[model samples]
Structures are given as structure tokens and as C-alpha cells.
Target: MSDKLAILGGKPVRDEFLPYGKQCIDEEDIESVVKVLKGDYLTTGPNVREFEEKVAQYVGAKYAVAVSNGTAALHAACFAAGIQEGDEVITTPITFAASANCVLYQGAKPVFADIDPKTYNIDVKDIERKITDKTKAIIPVDFTGQAVDLDKIMELADRYNLTVIEDAAHALGTEYKGKKIGSIAHMTEFSFHPVKHITTGEGGIVTTNDEELYKKLSLFRTHGITRDKELLVNKEQGSWYYEQLDLGYNYRITDIQCALGTSQLEKIQKFIDRRRELVRKYNEQLSDIDGVITPYEEVYSNSSWHLYIIQLELEKFKAGRKEIFEALKAENIGVNVHYVPVYYHPYYQKLGYKKGLCPNAEKLYECMITLPLFPKMNDRDLDDVVKAVNKVLSYYRK
Candidate 1:
């Protein structure tokens, strides 16, 4: 590959653009979806239950409820946690907007908390500082698949009597203190978007050890309707009797998607292993590049490595992240930025959220760049990314 910067009209790294993330669908995944299509039920069937059980078992959680998507999963979790009007839920502003939006969905106020600059996860101390009499729960995101400080968060939750609804959208396979993320948090939500470790086309789930929460989550997913004889207020009416116990949305995921999810789950360990391998390649190759800082690995947890991000050292680079990002794009390296702080959005600003609320998160947003990472990428693809990054950064180095 030529060393010339592609953005400057020199030879590019590759002919095709490589996306930052993609789903790896195999024959088994296709077959599973086909099987569900041929079956009698397409939604609200045995496949959904089986998939939920598989997810719950894999994460060592007692129950798992599947929802329409990751955002729905967060909303369902918030509803299950009883986050209502006038309540406050604390969460890091560094994550995808859905993390905070879920709180808003419940008519609750989302309190923005700063993040730990090293791990990119919510700072537990900031979470503590944000707690108030109105604070009902904490929605801590395991940003970049790195586990948050669960022990400390749980201690604070216990002391404050706050519900911990962990937004584990980036941490399906992450483990903390030898326990899987879904099992450790009071309630953990996982996304199955194509970019995530697994794909259900577009789906998400919430795992919890509490049966009450499980029931609530199940109800919340399907318009709060339930046919359970024990909970029915009019059980003697008829066998077809069902009741909507509370206000909920139509967030039920289809059986076809769940079947695909189950098949994908069968190979999740392999997928996660490949992701970690790619992360290793990135770290080993980019370590000497003084213009960028690699992601920090936490000692107490094993990340599933959903996204490999590098923060540009602006002081050492002549150009900013935007210029470098465009340069990498020109090189056919599909780099992306994970997030803008949730409060930075116009809607949030209108809702009284200010820009300077979370300084650490805001700073991270300015420099971090997400590089291509997926299980199916070959060694050559990995090399192309590294080469493109080096060429772009080297050209921009002051």
C-alpha cells in the first residue's frame, strides 16, 4: 500500500469501503429463520421462549425477556424498575441516546452523569453524586463492551435503595468479577443489532434474577397484556380472557427473529473470540502510533470487544478528528464515532440539558474514532484498517 494520504488524492488503501461493524450470518442462521417461517407461529411462540431461555442461561440469569429492539429493551427495563413521572434515573451521557431516552420514555427525568475517562464507562462516583431524593434508579451503560464498576455501583444502589437497570447494549459477552454482565446487574439489557456481537435482525433482551421483574418485563413487551390465571382479575370469565395490567407498548419481537437469535447465540463464543483477536491485532499494530491512544482494558473484566475505538491525540496531530475521519474514509477505511453525548442533542438541550454537564464525556466525543471490527473480517481487512489509519494519522502528525 502507498504511504501517501488518500484524502490528498493519492492512491487509496482499498477499492471498497469497510464498515465499522457488520453482522456475520451463516447457513445455520438462515436455516433457523427459514424454519420459523415454515412453522405455524411467527410471533409470540415457542421459539421466543426458547431463545429467551437460551439467552438467560448463557448469561447465568434467571429470566430473559425479548423485545422489539435495544431501545425497547431499555424502556421495558425502566418500566419494570418502576421508573415513573417525577422520578430521576442516573446514567452516563457518553452512551447512545437510547440509554437516557428510556428514562424519558417512562416520564422520568434522566440525570446525566460523567464517565470514567479511562474505561469510557459511567463513573460510579459521578453516579453517586447525582443521586437525589427523586432518584429512583441508575441506568449504567457498559460502554464499548467494557464492564462498569458493578461492585461499587451495587453498593451505592443498596445504600440508596435505587434500582440498577444496566444498559449492557455493548456488553453481551462481557464478564465482571468472573460473573457475566447480564447476571451481575439487577437488570441488564442487551442489543442484537447487526453491529452488536449477535444479530436478531433488530432485537434486544433484558435479563434479571427477580421473578417479579421478569413478569413485569414480559408484560411490558406485549402491551402489558397477560393471560396468566394467577394474575388475572377476571379469570372466571373465559379461557380466552386476557387483561392489560398496565400501560405498555407493542414491543414484542417476532419468532422468526428469535429463531435467528438462537442460532446466532450458538456461535456467540466464537464470534466474541474473533472480535477479541481483532482487537489484539489493532492494539499490537497501533501501539507505537503516538498520535492515537488505544482503548483501555479493565483488569477486573473481560470485554466482548464490540467496538475497537482509538482516541486521537489532538495535541500531536495537525488536523482534528473530522479531518482525520474524512481522510480515513477516503482511504476506504470506514471509521465512525460511537456517540455524541446524549444531552448534546437539540431535544435534550430544549429539555434543559446543558453542554457542560458532563465534561469528560464531551471531551471523549471530540476525539474518539471507531474503526472497523467484526467477526468475519480477515487478516487482510484488519491490516488495511491499520495501514489506512497509520497513513492518515502520519500525514496529519504535527
Candidate 2:
């Protein structure tokens, strides 16, 4: 092992930088987008409906509503769940801020639940403790593409008469107890960001089996304006007549994006397979390394493998996390942290949240690093990442 760290003038493992995640775009994806561009309807057209139907069918849901982005999907789900002022929604803290911010959008309070240290999902016991009469919904996130304890969450929701909206942004192909993530939740939301399993530039969709929630999602996406004759309260003056039924935003996604989503969805299984393979390789190679904790996969879950995060035993390392992170970056490995606890941010701090709210999430954030694990990575890339990690850890060993 080298005496000096990579950041301290030692030879680096890689000559080029490898980002933690990336989009896998193919010729077919480009061709689909081009086809949509050449067509007449660019926004809110047949392609959008087709993409929604395809997603709903793939996830075994009765309906899906495609929207502008993941944040909008959460917002729409909250709206459909009837989240309002003075309402409280429970969710995990170790997720993207959008998960909790979506509740704030509905003028509701986000009651953050602590995580299960082993699986890094929200602890059901903590969730149960946080529940109250004012709790209108529980928005459990499928963190790092692994399904949360959905059966337990659903049971709690049923007992308390609360809605469950699954924030499945990282779990496009994840499964729980043989059911797809989107199929089992009361309502599930998915993101089509570039870093996700599938890309549509930037888009989102909500899936549900309830017809009432489906109608509400559809209405919420298009400024609450519907021309459906049956939904109209007054007699229609003409075929072109439409009415605004509720206060909603214009969160409609373009058909161009939907076309790309449709094409990307065709290869989602292959993408997931590649990601899982990479994760397996990571586990096999990194498991024996001292002080390195590989992610835990629950028996009930088949994770989509959106991220491959490793937690370092901080007590065993001579260097701090920042030093290790910088050392890895110097080796041309684009490592990143998944998140800080949502309530630990400055905005949330100003809103009366403090640092020690979720101790497990805070502790996880301090030592975890996300490794490069995109579907586009090859054998050489994977080997290089492993080498860099090992080299860095060896150098910093206590």
C-alpha cells in the first residue's frame, strides 16, 4: 500500500473521472424523441397517454398520471390524499428533501421518522410512535431503490385511516414480496430523471389502483381543468368548453419526454439487471475489507440498485470523511453523499427542526459515500472503482 494518499501526490487508480451515476441513452431513445418532435402534438398528446398506460401496466396498477417532475408527482399525490393545513405526514429523513418538501407544499407538517439502521428504511416502530389523529398520510420512500416495509406501513395506514403514498423515485424496477413497488402502495410516484433507471429528460408519474385517486391525479396535473363531460357540473356550451374545477398547477409533461420515457421503459429490465450485477460485484469485492459496510438487502426486496453506498467505520479510520472523500475524488472517482437528513438543512432548521432529530440518519450521513454504479459502467470501470476504494481505505486505516 502507498504511504501517501492519492490526494497527497501518490499515483491514482484511474486516469479519468467516473461519476457516481449517469443516464444510459441509446440510439433507440434518440430516435423515439426525434419521432415525437416530428409529430404534431408536443405536449399533452397521445404519446403522454401511451407512456402513462405503459407504466401503469408494467407496474400492475390500474392507472397512472404522468406529470412534469418527481416533485410534482409528490405534490399531486399529496393533493389527491387530501393533505391540508394542520395535517401531518410521516416520512423518512434519509431521503431527498423533495420527499418532505412535498408535504410542505400542501400546507402540511412533515413528521420525520427515524430509519432502521440495518436496511436504512424508515422504522415502522418509529412511524407508529409518530402517528396521531392529525396524521393524514404516510409518504414512505423506497430509499436507495430498496422497498420500505410496505406491508407494515400499509397495516398501520389501514388501522389509522391514513393514506400511504410511496415515494418510489429510486425504485422503478424494485419489488417487494413478489409485487412491484408501484403496485402495492396506496399510491406510488416515480421519477424519470437522467440518473434514474429510465430517463425522460425530467418527468414523473403517479400510479394507483383507486379510480378516485386516479381521477384526482389526472385533474391535478393540468391546472384542474377537465373537459370530460361527466365531470362537468354545468351544461357544456360547446365541444371545446372546459372548466376549472379546483386550484391546481400546470404540471403536465411533454409528449416528447413521454416518447423518450416509453422507449427507455422498454429497456428498464436490462438496465436493472446491469445495475444489480454491478452491485453484486461491489458486494463480493468489498465485503472482506475491514471497516467497510456494504448495503443490506432485505429478504423481501429485490432492489433496483439505484445507488451502491458504503459506510465506513469512522472509528477505525485515521482520516475524517471529508479527507477520504477528497482522496477518492483525487483518484478520479466521483463519489457523493446520498443526502443530509431533510430536517437538518438550513430551511428546515429555520422552520424549528434541529440537528439531533434523527440520530441514525445523521450518523449514516457522516460516514457514507456513494460509489459509481451506473449501468453504462464496464468491467474496467468497476475494477478501477474497487481499487480506488481499497487503496483509500488502506491508506487511512487506523
Candidate 3:
């Protein structure tokens, strides 16, 4: 059968194409975007402030600064946290490249730590082992929406006088213990990409409770140009007068994106609840599979369920992970891998980063596969995914 025909056939079995993750847009989101489009300020306006305020309030953070993308948010957070040249920033290897690259962008070095095999987040013990006199910060990523062990990390950070910059791009609604991720970290970054819990086309936000850090991030999100007379050493009495303090980029987010984000934020609770339901179903369905290990959540952590990841046990299956991935794809299931270890990339390798530095992350890199899990998925779509997954796994087992 043709690929198109197979996809169409699967569509009937499913409500729609089961994207691994996606944005859930509604009438409110549309109306907000339309309102922004009709308004005079399309770039950096009142809606941006409104959205930032709402996010900060929701996360129990004192301030939030909207930026162009998650990467930009990370950059702003690192800068605001005072990362400087030759300083070492500890982070997990099993994350998006942006997590480590943000440290490099500040002329600092990124030091890799192993991840906790169960949670796939930066291991607090590994972080402590890697910390040195040059260590300046800990960039703990909430991988796959599971909150890292923040209590331990915060304790270590306090001991070392290091800052914590949370790569919470996958963990907007996730929590550690009773506190939210954004509020617990010294600085937290969130992505509003299509694949994230929310969507703003392409946007991110930096959240912080420290007033000084918040002010610094707010300035960095724009052009580091401030119109506030209080920040200026010499006040100029002109409406257009502004001071360019730090070298910054045009990382500002548009009002249109903020409007969309605000709309999406309104439904975040429902989105998170449905995702947990889907995860429960997946866990029940896949738990008995001999060669599969489902993602684990910590007792003290509340995951956002951004992506459902499972590891393939190569010993139990006749085929390799790649073959199983291909089989699922041929069955019209859109499965994908979460990431390769950041240090495995050419850029990091060129900088003398080596393998075996993070054994746990490297092991995960070989077996991890992200299954379709999103707020938009219905019962039919979920069932279709389960059926396809079972078919692939059965073949490999045989």
C-alpha cells in the first residue's frame, strides 16, 4: 500500500495524525491572536506585559521576561545569573543542545554530568562530583517534562554559592515537591514552541524571583536598552532617551505571540490533566511489554507529560532500535527520538568534549524513543498508537 493510503487508513482508526507533541489552539487563542493583529502594537507591547505577568503569577515567580525562543530565554537567564568567561556550568548531556550552548554563549565552559537513569534528568550526585572552583551554575533540564531533583540540586548550589538555571522548556506545569519548577530554580526558562505544552509560534520566557536578576533578564530580552531613568546614571529628560547598558540582542517577543501564549495559558490545567490521563493509559498498555522500559516519574515530582519516552531493551528484541523505529513509521505512526547527547554533537566534540564522560546519558541515547503524546490526542488516536507500537514490538520480539 502507498504511504499516503496507509496514513489515510490510520486516520480513520485515529481521530488525526498523532504528532508526538503539538499545540492545542482554541477559539480564545484565535480571538487573542486576531486582536493582537488588529492592534497598533504588533511588536513588544502591552500584551507582552500581560502574558508575562500571568505566567509569573501562575509559576509563583516574581517576574517573567518573554523572549524570541527557548534558546534566547536560556541565553538571557545565563547572562542574568552572571556566567562569565572560563566559568564552568554543570548540565546534563542528555538534553537539547541549547541547554549547554547557553553556557558557551556567555564565554563559559559547559561541564557534563550523568543523568539519573530513572528520571533521565541531571543527577545531583553527578553534578556535585563535577563541580570545581570554576563552577558557577547548574543548568538542570527537566527532561521530558519530569522535574529534576531540585531539593538536592538547590542544596548543592547553596553550598557552592552557584546559581541554578532550569531548562524548563519541557516542564512548564511540572512541580518539585510542593513548589513549582520556575519558582524553585534561581532562573527558569520555558518554551512556547508548537511541540511544547503551549504555543506562540516560537517564543520563550525567563522567570525569576530575584529582583536584580529579573531586571537584568528583562533588559536582555530586549536590546539591553533601558528607558527607566532610575537605571541610568545620568538622566536625560527626553521621551526618546534611552541607555544601552549591556550588549544584548533583539530577543524581544511580539505581542501577537504573547497574545497566543496568554490564550494557551488559560487552558493549561485542562491540557495537563488530559496528558496525565493519556500517560496513565499508555503505562497500563505498555507495562507488560518485556523489552520496554517506560519513563519514570519521581515521588516528589509532578511531570507535565510533554513527551512519552520509552527505552528498548536490545537484548530481548531480535531487531535493533532503528529497525523497530522504522517498523513503527511504516505502520503510519510518527515516532521520534527525543535527542542525542549534546556532547556527541560536532560542535561540542570540536571543543574536545568526549564520550564516556556521561555514561548514563550515553546509554539512554542508544535506546530512547519518543512516542506520540499530546493534548489533542483522543481515544482513537491513542489506541492507534498503542496498536502500532504493539505490532512493531511483537515483530521485533519474534
Question: Best candidate, lDDT-wise?
Answer: 2
Runs of candidate 1 with Cα error greater than 4 angstroms are: none
Give lDDT tens digits, candidate 1, residues 273-348.
Answer: 9999999999999988888899997898899988899998899988988998999999998899989889989999
The TM-score that candidate 2 achieves is 0.99
Query: Cα miss at 295, model 3 (Å)?
Result: 1.5
Alpha-carbon TM-score of each model against the true structure: 0.98, 0.99, 0.95
Total residue pair clashes for candidate 1: 0
lDDT of 2 by residue, 178-249 (tens): 888887888999999999999999999999999999999999998999999989987647998899999999
The lDDT of model 2 is: 0.93
Better of 2 and 3 by TM-score: 2
User: What CA root-mean-square deviation does each model show from the true structure?
Assistant: 1.0, 0.9, 2.9
lDDT at position 324, candidate 1: 89
